[model samples]
Target: MEKWLVVLGIWAMCAACAVLFIRGATAGSDRRASVREGARAASRGSAGDTRAALND
Candidate 1:
């Protein structure tokens, strides 16, 4: 019974680590994507402003 408990504890720890790693990876990807989108939007807005200025 003791041996079984030890094995189960190890398995649970491994599963928890895997879940944390996956969550971190996904969160990082999402953060990067949001940053990229924000930058793109800023650039587009600047370009539009420049075009309007040129027209004026």
Candidate 2:
């Protein structure tokens, strides 16, 4: 029983770490996209910038 509890705790910690890492990765990508879009807008003198613009 003790061994099982320890294993479960370790697994929970690993899962939590994975979730946090994935969230961070997604947010970083979003920030990069926003920056790219902002740059394009500034370059083109457009008032509106979007993620799709960066993607293109």
Candidate 3:
């Protein structure tokens, strides 16, 4: 019974780690997309004109 408890604890830690890794990966992609969009908006000179920026 003691060995089983240890095995369960190890598995729980592994699952937690996997969840965190997946969440981090997803957030990283979102940050990359946001940066790309920001760059495009900056290059188009939307900052100079408020009318040109629809989402802002």
Candidate 4:
């Protein structure tokens, strides 16, 4: 029983770490995309749109 509990705890920890890593990875990609878009908008001189994109 004790061994099973330890195994369960380890599995839970691994699952939690995986979830956090995936979330971070996705968020990073999203941020990169937002920055790229914002830059493009700024370059195009769309003042209002660029402000919104950069704010993201």
What Cα-based lDDT does every candidate model obtain? Answer: 0.99, 0.89, 0.91, 0.94
What lDDT, from 0 to 1, does candidate 2 have? 0.89
Which digits, one per residue and each the tens of the lDDT, describe model 3 over residues 1-56? Answer: 99999999999999999999999999999999999999998977765676656656
Best model per TM-score: 1
Off by over 4 Å in 2: 46-56
Q: TM-score per candidate, in order?
A: 0.76, 0.75, 0.73, 0.73
Candidate 4: where are CA atoms >4 Å away?
Answer: 46-56
Query: Which pairs clash in the backbone of model 1?
Result: none
Better candidate by lDDT, 1 or 3: 1
**Residue 5 in model 2: shift from native, Å?**
0.4
lDDT of 2 by residue, 1-56 (tens): 99999999999999999999999999999999999998987977653455557867
lDDT of 4 by residue, 1-56 (tens): 99999999999999999999999999999999999998997787877777899999
Candidate 1, residues 1-56: lDDT per residue as tens digits?
99999999999999999999999999999999999999999999999999999999
